[model samples]
Target: MRSRPKEPRVPPDRRETVRHEIVSLLTGESMTAREISGQVGIGEKEVLEHLGHIRTALRSRLVVTPPACLECGFSFRKRERLGKPGRCPVCRSERIVDPSYTID
Candidate 1:
């Protein structure tokens, strides 16, 4: 009887790098910081930090859909940061939509 070759196995702890994983996820669809955090099992703040670095490091465009105020319909187009703004300047409403990110 001929013996079959053993297949190499990857360790359970071995996983794709966080940034790479994030890139893959973003490639499929746009996601908010909170959504990315939930998918990657990381804090939302950390996700934003990673996104900041990815924005600079990635050759492909990293597009940011800025958050908008739900109440006043104000868009945060000029905002620099990735995180959601505290309040809307037009209406002073705290109800705001989260910014989404995508790689194009």
Candidate 2:
């Protein structure tokens, strides 16, 4: 039987590298957690955690655009924190837009 090839090991400093990359990407453009995950080669959950930790370290502000409800066009702009909303307060629609982040 042939053995499967092992995946390359991640560096010990991978978390720091990912955090740096996240800031760089956000500096260029605003993106959702999903988008950051794809570009940074990390899970969305990891991206969220990193964002939480790096909030005060960045030179520019970390802006989070709150998730919006698509059904009623309700903008969740007043939300004071990061993370997706459970449902639309106005329409109760689960079809909500994921919040995005940008450093500016």
Candidate 3:
């Protein structure tokens, strides 16, 4: 198994701009948090936070499809949080699909 070196974190002052940039990027296609983090050079957790802000900033333009349990097809539409759930409540399955976001 191999590990990659870490990338430098985006400065606090620039986070706002990055968040806006993220929204602009999403206008073209839906993307998961991991993909956003990799492309934006930030951590996954940071990407999640930015997503929340994006939701607030672009209420009419943003569209988020909540994650679902692949095994039992349980939808997380009721969950208010921004990240993926750990397990499925109906079937207790760990095979959950990640939520995706896009800007309309």
Best candidate, TM-score: 1
Q: Taking the tens digit of each residue's C-alpha lDDT, what string does model 2 give over 6-103?
A: 99997545655878889889985999999999998888888889998778676438988878888999999888667788898898999999999999
Give the Å error, residue 3, model 3.
22
Alpha carbon lDDT at 82, candidate 3: 79
Tens-digit per-residue lDDT, 1-104, candidate 3? 99899998876556457887798779879999888888887898999998888788777577778999999888999887879889999999999999988987
Q: What is the lDDT of residue 8 in candidate 2?
A: 100
TM-score of each: 0.83, 0.79, 0.80
Give the lowest summed-lDDT range of ten residues in model 3.
9-18
Q: What is the TM-score (0 to 1) of candidate 3? A: 0.80
The regions of model 2 sitting more than 4 angstroms off are 1-16
Q: Go through the candidates in order and give the clash count of each.
A: 0, 0, 0
